[model samples]
Target: MSDDKPVHTPLEIKLKLSLERQPLPNISYYQRLVGKLIYLTITKPDIAYSVSIASQFMHSPTMEHFNLVKKILRYLKGSVGHGIIMKKNESTQIIGYCDVDWAGNYIDHKSTTGYCTFVGGNLVTWKSKKQAVVARSSAEAEY
Candidate 1:
């Protein structure tokens, strides 16, 4: 990428476990793998849901969780070309969409908030986060 000329071939990448991923025998490797995948969410929106679910068990990931993360990575490897592309637009409109999952968190009984912002037809930003306070109703969840 440093070179001015565009590279015709896809960039080769090597995914490796980080230092934080090691040193815990009881912990599952899925936590670290999911963390990496979540970081990639900025470029790839397809794996957002899977990564989010896998990340919920970061505090106590299991062997099952690790296998799921590995599967996600394998899926990504086979679909590396999948990603969002920003194109030249004719209009300048900023749009936002918001959604809430009522009492979605099984652990804390909290709702999850999701939103996506777009610049014209391009997806500029998005996030899925657990709400801090418990809501009494779906309307309250959005508020």
Candidate 2:
């Protein structure tokens, strides 16, 4: 992917990937690539969701999954300097924001929750994770 065009987004917003898709035979390279991406997410929250989706197929990745990984690499290439920036500040106030998508995952019908916390205008933490149980309503998912 060294010569590949860079992408603005890590993963296509409309992409619907699943484990049951066509599998690529005998390739351990995908696992290694995903492992690196997982580590990259420590400082690159922009690719967190995309990496999470790609990581799910480590046990049995397909050509489609490989393509997604390439897309993420391309994104990284274009955003080599992109990352959280910390600066000196006087305020110590903490603020947080969170949101959820009800039944966002088509395969498991699970909701995904995302939250980010900030301290004095600097991002301190963030996370995105699938809910343990399927929510019956949007309100339930938010709760």
Candidate 3:
């Protein structure tokens, strides 16, 4: 970003970088970097998946993992001005969308549910919460 150079990375590369095949390495810097990315998720929804993937290894991160996270930082640097905007003149109706994945967490065997609401054509709020009970099915997960 110093001289208008944009750092480019494909989604597959991010996935590969995040796929850990060995035990975790030092994560002090990784923890700090992931914290910054989590903060950015407030406005950068596109980075959410990547940031979340990178954060999974925060307790033990490798050099490759750390570099991939830096790639995300560079991505943010170039796309700093990009974000979602709720237009004032859009639809006035409020609607919500929700989804749940049944027992998606391998470690806890818990489900995760997510919801987002929009007023008119603008998003007003969103949440991704873990379910309290283990879901027997996808339908049950939503309930």
Among these predictions, the greatest TM-score belongs to: 2
| Model 2 TM-score (2 dp) | 0.94
Off by over 4 Å in 1: 1-28
lDDT of 1 at 35: 72
TM-score of 1: 0.70
Error of 3 at 89 (Å): 0.6
Q: Identify the leading candidate in terms of lDDT.
A: 2
lDDT of 2 by residue, 21-119 (tens): 788775688888899999989999999998988887889899989999999999999998989999899999999999998898878899989999999
Candidate 3 — which residues are off by over 4 angstroms? Answer: 1-21, 62-80
40 in model 2: Cα distance from truth in Å?
Answer: 0.6
lDDT of 3 by residue, 1-26 (tens): 36545575413431444344564456
What is the TM-score of candidate 3?
0.66
Ranked by TM-score, the better of candidates 2 and 3 is 2
Q: What are the lDDT figures for the candidates, one per model?
A: 0.69, 0.90, 0.71
Q: What lDDT does candidate 3 reach at residue 111?
A: 80
Q: Name every residue pair that clashes in candidate 3.
A: 91-120
